[model samples]
Target: MKHTYTDAMADIETLDTRPSAVVISIGVVLFNRREPKVKMKELNLKFGKKEFRDEQIMMGRTVDKETVAWWKGQEPDAKRIFKQANVTSMEDALNKLTAFLTQGDTNYLIWGNGSDFDNTIITSLYESFGMQAPWKFWNNRCFRTFKGEHGHITRPPEFQGVKHDAVDDARQQARYLQAIYAELQKYNILSYKERQQ
Candidate 1:
């Protein structure tokens, strides 16, 4: 079946019984997407909901620019900074994400676990921004990765250990997806047999 945000939500209802299509994780590290094996030239996104109320609740709690910079052990690269239009509000965040999806040459979305909170936030932002969500692609059909599971994939040994430290978690997620993509290629090779009713 085709994937979408709606299908993803339904899948979330089924939890372990369902697989996710796309995810909407927070933090720069959470959004990395890089090719497997090579382990170089990462892609990152910088977007998040900014409901004034949510912002208030998050202050002194959620990682802020300063805190994230400190954690990175350096200042944020200029290009990696979230654009002002995207950071202004939750609506802006959605607008920015939509632009990222449509304006870019690439056509893929990933999430470490999008079905849960990330999807919810993006869904809200999309509506608030007055856009028709490509619900299917966003729902049940995007790629995904997980934390602390069997058949585990690990990042470059240099990046080394895996932990929930949002940074490492995100890298592990990319590694997991790289492995899944390889497995899917293997499955594609067997598809002809499955189709030969």
Candidate 2:
């Protein structure tokens, strides 16, 4: 089996969970999930609220009232970028994420928390700029589906950060995916080499 140590997980905090949602923050972690001790590199970015979101809304992007209502009930720290952040314009954030993912000429297996949420929303943001997403569409993976199929890997690794802080959230999600993948490997249902395929 060929060894291709190319994998990444990205998480985003957005105003709405839908494809047209305005993204507030993006967190991406590069790691080898098969490794026993995960080593990660991170790319974390925040979007300027009024400057970014308002422009997107003017350009036909959307916000959901219900999602806003839900955010109101969450802990203050969960809304990480909302309080204070070194923010960038919408396009700049996307460019930074692209640069991070495409570095070293690696073909990354990009995984997002949900098949339809994180990746889809990010892709939409890229589309607004008329640019292709950094990773190939064929390389996209969904951790939500992976977890659903491996339900018995019930216990997650200890989470050590605010739930909705994008950087911390991405790191924790990567750990969870690694844990689940290790469990699958243990059963010999799929081997390390097979997973890289």
Q: Could you tell me the lDDT of residue 43 within candidate 2?
A: 86
**lDDT tens digits, residues 52-158, model 1?**
32442333122344533443453343223322123555445445445544442333443535544444444443444456554444423233323333234334333
Best by TM-score: 2
Error of 1 at 42 (Å): 6.8
- Report lDDT (CA) for all predictions: 0.35, 0.80
lDDT of 2 by residue, 57-84 (tens): 8777888988888878889777546755
Off by over 4 Å in 2: 1-5, 191-193
Q: Return the TM-score for each candidate structure.
A: 0.42, 0.91
Give me candidate 1's TM-score against the actual structure. 0.42
lDDT winner:
2
